[model samples]
Target: MRILFGLAVLCAVVVTGISYFVLYRYVSDVPENKICGNIYIGNVNVSGRTKKEAKKLMEQHLKEDAALEITMKVGDKSAGATLEELGLAYKDIGKVVDKAVEYGKKGRLFTRYRQIKGLEKEKLVLNEGFVLDAEKTKAVIEERVEVLAEHAKDAGITKSADGFDITKEKKGETVDEKASAEMIRKYLNSGWDHKGFKVKMAVKTEEPSVKASDLESIKDELGSFSTDAGGGERWKNLKAGVDRINGSILMPGEELSVHDTTAPYDAEHGYVEAGSYENGQVVDSYGGGICQVSTTLYNAVLYAELEVLERYPHSMLVAYVDPSRDAAIAGDYLDLRFKNSYDTPIFIAAEIDSANQMRFTIYGKDTRADGRTVEYESETLTTEDYGVTYKENKEAELGSMQYAGSPHTGKTARLWKVVYENGAEVSRDVINNSTYEKSDQIVEVGTMSDNAEAAELVRKAIASQDKAAIEAAVAQAKGMSAAGSDNAGEEN
Candidate 1:
């Protein structure tokens, strides 16, 4: 019994010594010489180790698990606590350091867990701002440049004697290159992406040959004129008049006026006779037959369907052209002008024939409305009559203004409306109120008692186109009548 008890005691003492040694070694191995808080292997601090030892140990542990958890403190939280409860992780300190060293060589690198989180936020913000997709914006700016170039080309800058032309140079005083460049730059910097943007452009320019051809046609039409047909100087005078209208160019969208082109009436230009129009009781100086040219161009403009900016009609009946259809120009007071509103270029060709007839033709691309047709209708709206004015009978007495003579009646002024249509009634407009002047009546007073009877016999003779009849009428009337007399005596 004694021997067994001694053996048991010895065994117990040995076991106790072994336990103490093991505890001492474990406590010593954990560094106590450095600053201490908690033991951190990978930012994860566990109690019983110094901060330096934990950091060193963490670097060693990262070799095995590069993605180790990191430990963060919560309010009043204890060290070595569960990271899950604090919504944090203990990241591998050594791995982070290694990664930072690698990426830092290229650019910025995260230092701590907080820094990594901050970097993620910054990346998101940058993505929301300026994008790197320059293809779309670049294309949009390129397209704008092309369109601006085309517009510049169409605004033709021609060299002419009228002035120093500066339109053709790509960069010069007249070129709008700066404006175009700025427009394009502004468009690109407007923060738009043109990933799926589309553009449709139409470019137009006037051909040089077309412009030359138009001028040639005008010259040909005006050049064909002859003067020596009639014995009178009227034909010669008319030829000189037609020569004035030459070498004028009408640009697109420009208006050409008749009064603007006609030369001033002067003896130097061979205008011998002045034109006159009756106003009230007296005749007034006015441009005479210029209305013929104006009216002809007006008809041509109508046929071309150009935009009529302004137009006026003659005050008195004109025998050269239809009364209501005539267009009259009296300097700035009245004008026959039209604007070339078509997209293509247009030229006006005017010709005056030897017969004192004028014609105007417009040349341009055919712009006829394929599916449309126009119709015109005329309607009389109103009429008015002015009292007749009489001329003194050369054969009558001084107080005689009327006698047995052919009575001339005044004409009724009629207002007319012209309607224009295209598939439907486009517009209905009133043209003008046309007035006609009346012819006067006169009676011849003769020395014979049968003066009235003799005057009637003379009237029958005057009615004939025979030259002898006109002479006989004149002789009988003169021999029997006094100035301003109503009759030599009551007419037959």
Candidate 2:
């Protein structure tokens, strides 16, 4: 019996010692209930138990209390419990096995609890496509607040004053670059307070003007003139004329037509009726003698020796201007045009006066040698003749009287060649072949007296220039001659 009791005591002692060792281990491994001086439930003070036993106790305690449940009852619905709430859920009996297991899998239980506490304390920050940790979320919120403060400092949202002012309720000044950047930063960080965001911009205005030197150079060239005799009133007239030809700038290889520069024939513009030539007849019309200006300009162009593009003459011969000298225009129908032959600009000057005189002059850079000269020569090529026709006046008796008839109908082809050189022919060009028309003939029928009387009367009428007596005597003589010719033909 003594041996048995001793063995049993020894076994009991051994069992107690093993239990104490296990409890000590459990107590040593248990997390503290306070997280940085804040009370929590997951960390509990348990002693003399294994890890499995502590876990079973923790789970049993957590299941009993409504607040300690893994799922919390909110109204009639069950919602997921927060980490902080879960940490405080377990009873304060020994160590919390659930927390230990959870923490072991997810780092320190105390650290998780503290993080959840911090999340509950910090302001929420919502970012696009981002789920931030508690610390990061707090930092984001603080940064956004700072950005918004900076934007308020940089921004001026005051209303405009009256009129053009920018401080009244009617209008407001726009936000600037700094303010706009700050607002955008705030928007990206906090996803709240969006009243100050803006896209700012600036614009500048500019004015244009012509250079003084360019204007002066143009004026000098236009004012300068060559005043020789042929240069005569022509140059003066040209100077006066171009005074009105403003805004005309001719570029090299460009063509200019007189018709483009001249004002249209409108009575409102003070254009008067003047004599103009057309189809062999002279008539009065508005803007009539402007061709003189064209012709004069043509001459000046020749003097300047520019390139002639197109030129046409009056249909009939003109007395004021030579047959070949005149240039005619019928509004857009006809125009005298030329091209700037030089590699520079040329200004046209024209003048017309009450005397029906016109002159045209061109101003350009001088490009001629001292000894260089140009001359023109003309030659007749062919003459075209129209067959003659006779006209009789029924009111007068037949008569053998000849009167100075109207102008003849014929055509003359003239070759005008221009030679350019000092004395030798450097280049020769055929200008044109001109054609002219001839006039027609007409006869009057008159009565005749007796043959002897008619013969004497015809002779006297021819010598004395007596038209009436000649007609009477010719009528008498023609009757006798016709009767005699018929008799002679019968005898034959």
Candidate 3:
């Protein structure tokens, strides 16, 4: 019995010595300020290093991850942004390092020793938790995606000297904003284990609204109208306006603004000072004769049976077209707008003939029957007589007379569209109504005269509102001024 007890005591002492040695080794291997061995943070080995050193090493490794590039692609086109640009970052690197630092330095001595040994067999890799700002990620993703998108181009017809040139339509692509945002969110949150990655956006094809086939039906002439555009500086402006408007194609349900098409009427745009009517007097203004172009186009559009969205008549009556048939365009406000009411596209072909006639021909599929014909007629509703106005000129000698403005008769009228089928009148409808203002005849009479008698005679003639009387008085005053000048020379 004594021998057995001694043996058991010896075994117990040996076991205690072994345990004490292991405890001492564990204590020595793990420092108070350093992380234990076999520990990792995001693929970075933080073993046998202090908390500060481990944090630096892990941050360097994560810096590479943050700089990783992610590209959003559509076909061959691509746009890229970095993870850091997307506001991705480690949520709490310090807390993770603290946890790592206290890995084997917690609990009782034996438990701590056991944890250290366990780390030797298996690694304790602490995943650096990540966080991304929702707004930042979404905004970055959306901007990049928008830059990557392509716009669709419709097939259109451009007028050529030979005939017409048909351009092919280009296919376009666009992405769903919500889907793209979700896609980027999922990718960043998941384990993205790469330096760079390409994500194909969820794209959809956008087809052109007007295909080439739709414009094929625009061969026949639906309507043609012409007006005399006299030559000179005003004609130059008219030709420039026509050059801009020629070959314009109007798609179905599309409205064309004449002002928008031929605007910026300045010297740079090939316009010169010419005659234009303003407030009862012919005034010199830029883009003077462009109104004739719009008026001709208006007649053509009306004949084509197109819908006139907006049309404004001149403040005074124009000599080019009848009372209610003219359309005028001034600045941004007064514009001639018309829509292509047909199913097919409408092509505008404008040209200045050798006779100085501005003509506009509209081409589209003529759906009207062969025997059907249409015409427009202007009906006068009321008329006002024009008055005469005289202005005194101080610079003129004695009784000089000059015509300032022409007289215009004011009238209110309506345009009627008459349709005849098989040579019999079928319908007559009022298409548009217009009211024109009566403009006065302006005359400048000389009041600066040394002889009061001559000036008073001229004033009486002007007050009479008679052109013949004014002419006779002006002649008499001129004779008296010539006689007075002769007498003054003789006296000298």
RMSD of each: 29.8, 32.1, 12.1
Q: Any idea what lDDT model 3 has? A: 0.85
Tell me the lDDT of model 3 at 354. Answer: 89
Better of 1 and 2 by lDDT: 2
Tens-digit per-residue lDDT, 279-331, candidate 3: 76678899998899899999999889899999998888898899789999988
Model 2: per-residue Cα lDDT over 16-49, one tens digit each? 9986676555434535431222223323332333
Query: Residue 114's C-alpha lDDT in candidate 1?
Result: 31
Predict model 1's lDDT versus the native.
0.43
Which structure among the candidates has the greatest lDDT?
Answer: 3
Q: Mark the regions of model 1 whose C-alpha exceeds 4 Å error after superposition.
A: 1-242, 274-276, 280-287, 354-357, 371-378, 383-387, 391-492
The candidate that achieves the highest TM-score relative to the unseen native structure:
3
- Candidate lDDT (C-alpha), each: 0.43, 0.46, 0.85
